[model samples]
Target: MEFVPEEGKHLHEDCSTLILPALSIGNVGQLVADLLISSMGSERVGYLDDPNVLPCVGNDAYGPFPQGDLALPLEAYDSPSNALTIIQQRSPVVKGMMIEFAKNMADFLAGSGKKHIVVLSSLDFGKWQKVDMSSGLQIYYLSSSNSNGTDENCEQLGWKKLQEYDPSQMHWKYLSDLAEGNVTVEDITSVEDELEEENYYASLPFAALFSFLKAKGLKVTCLLCYCSEGDNISDAFQLGDAVCKLLQLSHPTTGIEGGKWRVPLSWMSVYGPPPDVSIF
Candidate 1:
């Protein structure tokens, strides 16, 4: 993978923390990324060129109007004031290449001097066996950091460490071993065929990315939400606020009146135009 910098913008060295979304259920992670990028006024520094990502292009996502800036499959942004770097992925990796994509990302991030990585994703709400009515929406976290401090911090913020993240589970162990190079492709291919999609954690991009990032010796924290398909805009905003809390950043807001969260203009047509008013 190669990073092609924007004409005058380069990746910032001081922006050591990276926040990216894994394409997953509900596309909540992507929506949260949109909020963060727009609210923080992050500048697009470059884009990633990789064959693993299916190609896509669209008008600028965050602008109040179509600004003529093109968006790509994977683009990098930097917010110097916040000392943060963000990656917005507009396309999914090709099927059967998730691990390869993760490896490429791990290598690039490690080489780029990134100290911490925050991965955001959504899980199938149906997989959650229990629902707590008192809690509006439960957020789960899995950290690669050995430090107990990370857990303590998240706990203090009312987040639960993902209890399902047992690396000893057969599928989970397989991914761990794969990331550490203890398993061969032949071994993986054979076992993968026998694995069932019912093992929810193993199937999502977060699992592959987390395992690979951990093997790269980087501190990674994954924040996940559970939701069914529908309008997930509220879920995205909640998770976005959770992320800001985790990082100790203030809730960012655009200059919109009576609104704390900034919704990108591109969202207006996400579900297509509103029904014709005259039809009412």
Candidate 2:
């Protein structure tokens, strides 16, 4: 619904595989983007860049607000989604430009004849940890499912994303008694819960997009690589690893030459300082 039909340009010959990552809080999406870019390269994958347009129903920032500029909209970087409080050494990556670019990419994937789209992500769950920031998070496997739950997605492509989370297994809740202090302990847990939920919802946009794709009969697969809540994990590294796994999962044994169709080559331009694959 958000995307306009036949708005995106064709980047590849045909059937270009797409991988979209969340690229926010947990860095799972960013990690996936980095990995796909590194694997695909720039020349091969075309970046979907769309001009400024009035939003479908929301503001250029997080979501549609009641009021504020409806005419001559501002650039995406100026939106609230890009605004971060400077928590540590990071800033919000999902802003106006990134989002529109993603939309254009969706247009390309849908109309450009590429039926397969894969979105990569990393997330956190509330699991108690002893040392704090050293807990391992559970990784979830969510595949897109159609209304019938038995379309081509299930038969050929294997679509099945909507799965219930087992709080007992996936939810990691730290006991309050183990807190370092009354203030720090409660603060940590609350922060963890917020991050966990945010990461989970971050994947929703892609899910929504995939659902849209399904309406058009396009097959979309979302691969999420979860990170532990407090392990001080490298989301970037995990993304790369996830990319390799996704590629393998989509197709077994056949390397890139085998027509596995890795992500388009836009990695170098956007995600700079590529990870030393050896380092991962």
What are the per-model C-alpha RMSD values against the true structure?
Answer: 2.1, 15.0
| TM-scores for every predicted model | 0.94, 0.44
Q: List runs of model 1 lying over 4 Å from the truth.
A: 147-150, 252-259, 276-280
- Per-residue lDDT tens digits of candidate 1, residues 177-222? 8888998657868667566464778768998999888888999999
Error of 2 at 207 (Å): 2.9
- How does each model score on lDDT? 0.86, 0.38
Model 2 per-residue lDDT tens digits across residues 97-154 = 3333344445545665554655555544432122223433333344435432233433
- lDDT accuracy of residue 218 in candidate 2: 64
